[model samples]
Target: MNDINLEKLRVNRGAHAAPKKRRSSNTRTWIIAGATLAIIVYALLPKPTAIQATQVVSAWPSQQYQVLNATGYVVAQRKAAVAPKGTGRVEWIGVSEGDVVKEGVVLARLESRDVAASYQAASANRQVAEAAVTSAENEMQDADRNLDRTTLLFNKRLLSVLNLQDAKSRKARVAASLKSSQASLAAARANEQLAKTNLDSTQMVAPFDGTVLSRSANVGDIVTPLASAADAKGAVLLIADLNSLEVDADVSESSLAQIKMGQPCEIVLDAYPDRRYRAEVRIIAPTVNRASATVTAKVRFLDRDPDVLPDMSARVAFLSQAVNADQQKPVMAVSPTAIVEGEGGSHVFQIGADGRAHAVAVQVGAVLGGVRAVSGNLKVGDALVLAPGSKMSDGDRIKLADAP
Candidate 1:
């Protein structure tokens, strides 16, 4: 088969054919050109410039500032339920809801009339016992004298032995009776003291200087013991020291690390939108609430106002940095869009006085609202790159959007 093919077949070369590997070489050249064109197109695409970016200088009252935000309710720092210490029917309300009273001032009274009457009865009984005790003392003295006489008679044998023995027995009986009367008097006095204690407990008094939040009881209303029958008897009055106020905030567990005792905070109440209260973090609960993935934080106001009422909705911001009155200074700020990512870190492109774009590295801190506080390489009045697209580069020419 090889001999026949060699005799009859001869290969033909056409114009389309070229020198050895010419097709491969041409294909490689086209590939290179296409790649070059792609790069050129990419480079030519229109992009934003420094003029497009809105920039501001770095200046802030304090460089380090933290605004940790959470929401909570205002609570009374010192709250108490004004309930009767001893249970009884309420007789009179000396104070009503919204009434402000001093500590130890009676807000209400129970039906202590029965207790008073019982005390009086106990007093009468005590008086009778005292009288009996006096009689007993007289008898005791008589008994002692009789015993002495009996001893003398027995010693001298002036009286019969049976008569002396009878005299001694009579004296002993009178001494026992005197002792009994003394015990009765003491028991009556003890009963009177206990009754007085119960009667005194029947008076419900304000535990501290506070305003009554509620008046749970009125004349003739029955109140029971808080421990034994609290379910059946709710608190008679909710009193709280309004001056002692606190913020009970719930912070997410992830942000709990930022919280600590004495951390400065800014609290805004929904009830008062225009006002802000200065506060400090007083407690950061160590235990996390597993179910809610939150932690309870308590804050105390450095300055309190009476208008800040309990249960007011409040927003809390725990600050890692604080800005005191003396430390407050104005910093040039711009829209957040002005900042951009650069080689080593964050940078900003600004339009210089000559109206040229320049990339400068900037130290960035907390991002708030739509502005970022920046430091280094920028100053007030410098034109910042609002949002320079990919086409922007250092040393690039720029013009403000509305420039002539």
Candidate 2:
């Protein structure tokens, strides 16, 4: 009986130890299953895509019709460096930079005291010559009468032949003196004209209607026809006809075929990027630059702007058609790649503040340069994704591949 009880107790102890081992094995299995589930859940979550972005910009409607684009500068076709014809010291200036002048307007005056004095002296000489000529005419009249009387006396035989011969000789001498005095009067008149011309040269006048760009000479500065001397200025005023302002743009020789003399163009000055000017091709240079392989195209403005200036950096867009008055204003534009077409129509994935892309519905309009004009809940400088993939959806997180 004692051996039987000990055997039963040993069997009970083994059964209890087996239950503890099974419990520990079950605990480890549960822990491994929980870890597997966590891993699968992590794998199913959404991942961010690396992408590039562009900003919405204010663009012109004319850009849609752009065939070619080129950079250049505003040039005045009627530009001139106005200088005096005769060299002299500058005495007075009547205009400054930015002054508008008309044709033949006197801009400055040189030292003319010496020239004026010469003119005055020549005038006095001319008057004296006139007086002398009058006296000579009276003397000639008297000589003619005396010769007639001498002839009559010789014919009547009332006077000796020697007396008549001496009277004739005196008349001939007086006639010769009259001729000499007449010649002197002509010479005096010529001298007066030359002196008057010299006096007129002392004043500088405008060549055409233009705006003064600069005043190169000041009071007491020497001005010369050619600025070869270090102390002499070549031009008193740098003037340009603002009406003749044009853009000299360089176009590639290969693209020159598209350019036409009457073709319309849009001009945007670097100084005023927001402003657009209406222009047209005025001239196409017949020659091409061998070094740059480019040809110059001259563009003229259709309407003049007071702010447009010479040599201001500019960009030219050669267009297929002219922009109307209403289309001249700016419009919202975006890259074509950023637009996504769907059953719901066109939309763009603009990156929201939360780093996720939000679809903004857009009504796509004209194609501008490399971008498309769109009207929607968009503004200038809003970030949009470029080339969104098929898997991309609304509210999907995105990682920027580049800084916006």
Q: Number of the top candidate by lDDT?
A: 2
**Tens-digit lDDT string for candidate 2 (1-404):** 43566655564566579889999999999999999999999889877788899899988888778999998999999988878778899999999999999999999999999999999999999999999989988988988888789889888998889988888888888888888888999999999999999998898889899999999889999988988888889888899999999999999999998889999999999998898999999999999999999999999999889899999999999999999987899999999999999998999999998999998999999887878899999899999999997778999989898644
> Candidate 2: where is the Cα deviation over 4 Å?
1-44, 139-179, 401-404
Q: TM per model?
A: 0.61, 0.79
Tens digits of per-residue lDDT for model 1 on 1-404? 33566745756666447665797998899999999999999889654342554647544444345557899999998999877766677778887778889998888888888888988888899999999999989988888888789889888988888988888898888889988999999999998888888888888778889998887666877788664654345568899998889999999988877778898887779997656667888888778889999999999888869788899999887776665764344555666677777668887787777667888887876655457777776677777778776667787877788776
User: What is the C-alpha local distance difference test score of each model?
Assistant: 0.78, 0.91
Taking the candidates one at a time, how many backbone clashes does each contain? Answer: 9, 0
Root-mean-square deviation per candidate:
17.9, 9.4
Clashing pairs in 2: none
Question: What would you estimate as the lDDT of candidate 1?
Answer: 0.78
Best by TM-score: 2
C-alpha positional error of residue 212 in candidate 1 after TM-score superposition, expressed in Å: 1.3
